[model samples]
Structure formats: C-alpha cells, structure tokens
Target: MKKTISREALKSASLEYNDVSGDFNWIKKRRGPIKVGQKAGSINHAGYVVIKIDQMKFMAHVLVWFLKTGEWPTLDIDHINGIKTDNRFQNLRHVTRSVNLQNQRKAHPNNHTGLIGVNKKGPKRFLALIQIDGIQKSVGTFENAIDAHNAYIEAKRKGHPGNTL
Candidate 1:
C-alpha cells in the first residue's frame, strides 16, 4: 500500500500492460533514455523485472497486482510456474511465506548438487531430503545422485506435485 502510483498516473506515465504477454510499454516519450512504446522494466539480479519511475523503483509483479486490483498487496507474490520473469497475471498469486517457499525452484546457496533437494552425504552416498510444512525431512540415501534426486522429487511430489526443484 505504500509508495503507490495511482492508476491514472500509471496510465499517463508507463502507459499500458499487455495482460496476455505480461509486457509493459511506454506510451509517450520521456525526457531521458526511455522512448515512447519502448518496453518497461529490466531483469534485476534476482531475475525479477524492475521498473523505475520518478527515481523510485518497483517490482513489476507488485505493480501488476496493484494495477490489476487497484490496491497494493501485503503478502508475498509467488510465481506459480517458477519463472521469475514471467509476469503474466494468471501466473502470479498472493501466498504466505511458507507457500512461497514451497514453490521455490532454485537450490540453496549451500546445496552443491546440481539437482535441488539432493546432496552428497559422504564420499559415495547421496542423500535426498525435502521441506514439508516448513520443516526439512530426510527422504533417503542413494549411491547414485540421480536416484537421490528422483527420491527428492518423489518426496516433493507427495507434498505438492505442481512444483519441483
């Protein structure tokens, strides 16, 4: 609800949002580097689209929610399909922190396995684990990394099959 740009101001400023394509565009020329009809926003470090106006920056998803609903949201926005830059209205949802974490598609920074939820338990053993209801629980150990990964996926499926690392 804070730092809100009114819908009218948004239309006069950023111009339009293509709901189907999830793309925003400038309708009129601006004073600086932006040109009319140019695409708005750029991918930030964490892979989300960011838009800047009047020296203030906004997350495109947040803006989309605000523009679509005419009210700012107070909860985390989860990209249902796990694609950070896909801002399609249908692909976004408001969820609690735990639900948002459930849909996370990236491995933790400390996770060394190329596959998420699997880790090397020892020199030759691979361990599979998953987070359920916010608690991390072990699935099983395997001699092959792929098996460990599969075990993790199966464990994850038992919880929420729509999302996997």
Candidate 2:
C-alpha cells in the first residue's frame, strides 16, 4: 500500500536542508551535502529539497510564492488573460499547446493573417478564425483588424464551455 505522510507530521519532522538557502539545520550531524530526492528529476519542483510544487499543476501556489516572496520565476507563466504575467488565480488557466496557440496575439507587420484574422484572396478584408479542440472555426470577415479581433473573442467565448471569456 502507498504511504501518505500527514501535514502535521511533515511540519514536526526535522528538515535537514532548505533549498532556498544552502544552510542545513536540525539533527546532531553537522551540515553536509543534501541528497537529492527520488523525484528530483521531475521538472517544475526539482530545485526544492522538500515538498514537490508543480507550478503547472498548481498555478495558485506558484502565484502565492511569487506574490509573497517577490521572486521571479525562470519559466514563462502565461495567464489566460491575454496578458502574459497577470498571475491572478482567477485569470490563470491551464492550456494545451493548441489552445495556447489559438490565444496568441497578432504578429508584427508584414505578417498578414498571422493573428487578429485570416486573410482571404482579396486585400484589406480579413476573416476572424479561432481553432479549439482541433476544430477550425471562422468567426467572420471584417474591414478592420479590431472588428476581426472582437469577432474572434466572441467566437472563443462560444467555443469554450465554462471559460471566462
């Protein structure tokens, strides 16, 4: 059977080392090199010597650590807000590769139909399209970029169930 350690037990247990700092405390043995845990190779929480904290799985915890500690993470934490670093739990959302691509912003100049809308055979006019769940959906065509973007947003809201679009 799998063994589960209670939070109280973990709290009372002696912590030999703190990954945040190089110092070691507790126990009679002098400070020495800490042995890496069995789950050390796992990404997200690999650096910490204690409990595993998977930022991808538990984004709220990641935001809490950042907000309370003011430590910037090395990895890119994208918020579903279209704003890359909002980090608010309500605004934060887990996204797959395709879904993330669907939410990407428009590319720079010279890149037509890269975002905002899809270009037709004609010039200036564009069709707003959003791909969700591997299905391509055309929102509608418009004369202006903003109109196309708005259409895309509306379509996104419709496509994603229970999504705070």
Off by over 4 Å in 2: 1-78, 88-102, 107-110, 113-115, 162-165
lDDT of 2 by residue, 1-165 (tens): 322333343334342333343222343322344343311212244232233322113233243334434553444334565654333445444445445455556554665756554554357787777777777878887887768878877887778653444
Which pairs clash (backbone N, Cα, C closer than 3 Å) in model 2?
none
lDDT of 2 at 152: 78
lDDT (tens digit, per residue) of candidate 1 on 88-119: 99988887776677776667888888778889
Model 1 lowest lDDT segment of ten = 156-165
**Where is the poorest 10-residue window by lDDT in model 2?**
48-57
Which candidate wins on lDDT?
Answer: 1
Model 2 TM: 0.41
